[model samples]
Target: MRGLFLLTLALMVPGGVQATLPPPPGGPTPAPRLVSFAPPPSVVVCKGGEARVVESAPIHARIWQPWIPPVIGRAAHQIPPPPAPPTADIYTFSIDADGAVIDLSRPMAPTMWPGDEQAAALAKWRFAPGAPIKGCRLDLAPTTVALS
Candidate 1:
């Protein structure tokens, strides 16, 4: 009978039987998958101001004080003195760690238009690498007094 049907087709041809085939119902045997290459946190602009890296640190003031002169005054106030009342200018500083300008002071009160060019443009401000605000107060944008 054709040599017993070629020995039952060589034992039904499927060699290893798919290695005992039994892992398809998803039950147990899946614990070998861990991959992490690192290097994914970098937003450093801390040479005077600018930083970002929230979940992994380095979240300092990213570019503090770009144009804080809503109106400092004296663009043209020549020969019109005597009627002063409105005033504001409280510049204080302390930003180090790369963003320079440390321990700057400016407790304004008596104005005749002389902030030394706004303290020399905040001493060439620059910021980054934060968390070191010892007395950082630069409030000079509040002049809406019309109580008449």
Candidate 2:
């Protein structure tokens, strides 16, 4: 009876068996690191009567999504009229592998003002070097003119 009680006591103790096992070994985990970037300098010269050089680019346009409230206004409060849309302006410009300029009319649309102006600027202008653009152009409409 004494020997049987000792055996039962050993089994009942916490970690009595697992404590005899060997410890596990360590391992490494691989990770990624970033590198540096450097760009070159460039200059643009515009000549002639409001001339611009616009290289075409892939249009990355997104659809305009406006959210409307459930009700126009509160029932009790009187609301003033919403402000009118700003006057639309025309713009034009051109781009190359390096850079671009805006407000060169040459019959094209505008760059700074609105979509319709930009479309008109694109339709009328021409480009040089024939390279692509991931760039932008900005200029006041009609009054402002550029040469590139």
Candidate 3:
């Protein structure tokens, strides 16, 4: 009776029943199961506050009188520019994630102040990479900044 029972049990059990899928046409499929999958969380750390000025551009442009001859002596060398009208243009700009200055614009640029030169100078500025910031103000000639 015991020998018969053992033989019956051994024959009933299946041999090497692997829980694997059929090979796919692309390649053998990976056996990883995505049970309750939640993607990893990401936190964006932004740098803010005042942007330090590393390289500074001169805000003043000197004027030289070409008509004044060399006979005028040292006085002809450096001629101070005429006083600019009380027109201050505030340039608005932002910094990108790569710390490069972007979105530079001056709504009402003064005639004497070259907007292109000032904007180009600001564009080359690179600060610490950070989140998007708006409402940054820069007084053109003075180069005063209120960056956030």
Candidate 4:
């Protein structure tokens, strides 16, 4: 886990990681990791190596967290307005040759949902890194967490 945390930290550091989304055509394209039940938009950027998801770590985020109950008022119209939804972003992670998540970042614009715990959880994703494939990608979107 420490390794994963360090790796996640490294990924957050600017210019510390090496993995690209699909570039303009004519360049070596990243290969899909495998046949996915969900649409796999990203791929592993390996050299003739194939990787399969040995195990997918479950990413748990409370959809509505820290719910603050409204104070009771006899007026009966004091129900606090519902909490607004938190902003979200798409985080793309890269798996290393060892199948551990080595890099994580928001390919899109910066978002409120910081990728800290998300990184730790994503780090646990296990992959079958055969033939030393350059590695594959996993994109995630975190929902606003709330206390039940």
Candidate 5:
């Protein structure tokens, strides 16, 4: 009887059945899920004019974040998507005499915006005048539909 029961149990179990199950319904797809992130303050302070500040940030083209579907978007898109991911922005910030963030600038390229949201969000930024920026705090938050 014991031998018979053991055989029955072995037959019931599927051969090589993967123990791990797929993602739950309405869950994120297992895609490449590309995410690019730069630690806060890529470029610190530069003692030149405004032009110098812009030069400090890596002025190049590179993907910042990869967007996924809504369910997986937030999870995969943890980093802030560049106006144009994979493309570096001509980023610059200025502080007033009081060390408050006064002027913040990010030049837009053709790739920056697929829609109007990017332009609008970038324009609305207001930094404290003369804000003593110890590092490059570009787009302090994620640029998304909700935040933008």
Candidate 6:
């Protein structure tokens, strides 16, 4: 009974078993050391004049999606004025290989929204860097964001 209890206690203690392996031929391995280096400078330039617009992908919601307020019921004899329809302003710009906006053209004439607002939003936009486009044209459209 004493030997059986001792064996069971040894089994329960994880330190009772250990893994041993031969050291590497070189000797004990050295601790890993971190190496840091700066990346090469990236310079993207748009060719003189406008680049042919290969394909104008639809504006992604992550970039700019408008919000529409819900209509609440008013009290009797208290009719609330109808809400004005949301307006959309289209913008054109060029992007580089890394999706950085190389050159941002002025907003099309007669835009209800301000150009600076559109530019500020666009500055945060990024695209996959595969094929580099010289002067790509991007269109930004406004649409209501659906609530989940």
* lDDT scores of the candidates, listed in order: 0.45, 0.36, 0.48, 0.49, 0.39, 0.45
Q: Give the poorly placed runs of model 1, Cα more than 4 Å off.
A: 1-47, 50-82, 86-92, 97-104, 107-139
Q: What residue runs in model 5 are displaced by over 4 Å at the alpha carbon?
A: 1-32, 47-85, 110-148
TM-score of each: 0.23, 0.23, 0.42, 0.41, 0.29, 0.34
Pull out the clashing pairs in model 1: 48-99, 48-126, 48-127, 49-126, 49-127, 49-128, 50-127
Task: List residue ranges in candidate 3 displaced over 4 A.
Answer: 1-49, 54-60, 64-84, 141-148
lDDT of 1 by residue, 65-91 (tens): 112222233333332333333345566
Model 3 lDDT tens row, 1-148: 9999988877888783458754333322223221111221121122445654444344333232122122222232354433334346567777666666678788777554356655666676666556655555666433222121
Q: Which sequence of candidate numbers ranks them by TM-score, best first?
A: 3, 4, 6, 5, 2, 1
Q: Order the numbered candidates by lDDT, best leading.
A: 4, 3, 1, 6, 5, 2
| lDDT score for residue 133 of model 4 | 45
Candidate 5 per-residue lDDT, tens place, 63-90, comes to: 3344434442344446333233333434
Task: Give candidate 6's whole-model lDDT.
Answer: 0.45
For model 1, the local distance difference test gives 0.45
Tell me the tens digit of each residue's lDDT in model 4 across 75-125.
334544444443444555555667766666656643334456656766666
- Give candidate 6 misplaced runs (Cα > 4 Å): 1-88, 143-148
- Candidate 2 vs 3: which has more lDDT: 3
Off by over 4 Å in 4: 1-50, 63-88, 142-148
- The better-scoring model by TM-score among 2 and 4 is 4
Name the lDDT value of residue 97 in candidate 4. 64
Model 6 weakest lDDT span, ten residues long:
32-41
Who wins the TM-score comparison? Answer: 3
Which 10 residues in a row give candidate 1 its minimum summed lDDT? 57-66
